[model samples]
Target: MDSEPPAAGIDVSKPHPARRYDYWLGGKNNFPADRASADVVAEAFPTIRLAALENRSFLRRAVDYLAEAGVRQFLDIGTGLPTAGNVHEIAQSIAPESRVVYVDNDPIVLLHARELLDSSPEGATAYLDADVRDPADILRKLDESRMLDLDRPVALMLVAIMHFITDDASPYELVRTLCDALPSGSYLVMSHATSDHMSAEELADTNAANQRSGVPFRLRTTEEFARFFTGLDLVSPGVGSVMAWRPGEWRPHPRPEAVAMLGAVARIP
Candidate 1:
């Protein structure tokens, strides 16, 4: 853990999803506005906190699996505010030579990433202030910066962020472009929010509240979310709830409430 440094572009007025997510995960790097909005969302959908925790756990498992499968590079986009067991930490723990490039549109997340997302001596980490909708810009910046070798296998992580991109944003095309750019052995790890686990009234309430909060969360169906990985080969267990995807020894078991997000890992072959 790093020191409690000041955050950059920490807007206290408008509510940002990354900051609100940080607040939900029990981190202190969020503004009052973020906390208020997160509280409202959580109140509407009480299992939101569980969803965040499960999503984080899924990230750890996915990175570990990728690193063990010889993936030494990682590109984590829409990375929310830093918390325990981040991408670099998980990858480097399995293989110290892992390299990670984190991208996020949130300036506050970029600031925290620079301060807290430290890398091992044998590895490297960099932050890009960019949006997920601009895959070309991300690839260009990555090339110009020479942070990670594109020819090598890299894990593309888009955990719990796609719901923020509505159909109008062309999220599928963005994901396809990035996946197409990667080599055969590269991986795509994703966890997306869905209404599959919630009742009609619950889903309606969640949608209405999100509209009011300005987060624009678009919950997808299991099949709809799977479409993002069009040509990729899904890993073992295929597309399923985050809690059920390769969950090792974690006690108490995963209930439907905590596993609201669908998780999947696919290879570009």
Candidate 2:
């Protein structure tokens, strides 16, 4: 794992969700602080790593589904480290003309933005250094770049990132603001962390770990998680474990309780 060199405004002494997630996914782009924080959560919830991996798989499946359904543009917010099977890669594989814009506020992600810029010859990909909480700026940049057209349908990828936005941050409205910018046929694919699948003891341990996790995290219940899709039309088998959502031929996905992340896809009518 190559440690990240210090960049302006980035403190390696504290853990960040993207780096923590990278550690969970067996990636080499993380620091000791991230590893320590991740270990704390893993100690409390043994399936934390599985949940990260399964959430990633859900992203791939959702991209596959949207590509086959004829969506050619993707606006992926909270874009973490670029790994294999990224949004444009999956979409372009099926439809070579897909265009994707990846957004993230983390300086480290911006440093590696080049990894995500490798677009297919027929498609286009761009990385934006912005925060999801500021939907206005994101849209402004998108409009300026013309990388994606708001007049057309796009798949909004919010996978595993919402949980980091605490309730005080108005997470639901933040999501709605983004969804509202898209055309009617656009889709929102999301996966959020939840305590619904945990035992009482497990919940306590995780809650404790979260206090020192170096970020604001809210593990909502199934009902709470569903609120983000309030005005949208949910796809079939909506709001269940990511591991269980359209597992396809991989029928016997690991137990939902073990993968404690709720995944769903909703179409804007």
Candidate 3:
């Protein structure tokens, strides 16, 4: 890809979800193993690549909206391998004083963060090597970094990552814990894959293929995805297909529902 070797301790032998996603986005950071796995998924559902692009576009629009609303700090959990229009870039471009903290357990992502996620002089950016399931650890890392002010309003981004967490892990509870830790005015930006539109056979085939690829995929319903924002005020055009929320001509997906991803932005009151 970039001529840079895989970061130390990175397992290149197995296909990682982040790398597979990068492959779907037409990025060159993925290996043959990831491409092979992605090929299987593409064959099963030809729209997966489109779904990835739609989710990314949703991320950009959501961040832009948040920035316009005067939210200057961001806590992006499950921040996968960095791609275009990252949180810091979008936020800082709008307000140079914006501060962003990215969290992910992948060493390779951390290795590349310094190079790709640079911040403006007036703003700051930091990365946390932690998992989404461990809210306390994430908070502790944020506390240690002091990169963001907890008392101030921060946008907690859970985009395209929560689906990886199975129900047994108490994904809902985990999200509640993270949202609870934020201030009253903080916002929650989330996007998740769903089985609501997929047929039983399609779900079965996709799950089986994902299992073989080593990436845990759990497709939640729209209601289940909405539970993460319980007791919060949803932004306009709430909880719909990712491409339908504030759709712009930037990256148009004619049939967003076909992408099978639901997204929304809400504020914790």
Query: Which predicted model would earn the best lDDT?
Result: 2
lDDT of 3 at 114: 89
lDDT of 2 by residue, 53-108 (tens): 89999999999999999999999999998898989899999999999999998889
Q: For model 3, give the RMSD to the true fold.
A: 1.7
Give the alpha-carbon lDDT of every model.
0.86, 0.90, 0.87
Instruction: Give the alpha carbon lDDT tens digit for every residue of 1-269 in model 1.
Output: 22254455455678888888888788877776777788888878887888888889999999998998899999999888888898899889999999999999887786667654588999999988888888999999888879888888889999988999999998899899999888889999999998897789988998988888767779999999999988899999999899889998868865766658899999999
Whole-structure CA lDDT of model 2: 0.90
Q: Candidate 1: deviation at residue 25, Å?
A: 0.7
lDDT of 1 at 232: 91
Give every collision pair in model 2. Answer: none
What range of 10 consecutive residues in model 1 has the weakest lDDT sum? 1-10
- Candidate 3 residue-wise lDDT, 76-146, digit = tens: 99888888899899999999999999998877788778854589999989888999989989999899999
Candidates 1 and 2 compared by lDDT, better number: 2
Candidate 2 residue 110 C-alpha distance from true site, Å: 1.0
- TM-scores, each model vs. reference: 0.94, 0.96, 0.95
Stretch of 10 with least lDDT, candidate 2: 1-10
Better of 1 and 2 by TM-score: 2
TM-score-sorted candidate list, best first:
2, 3, 1
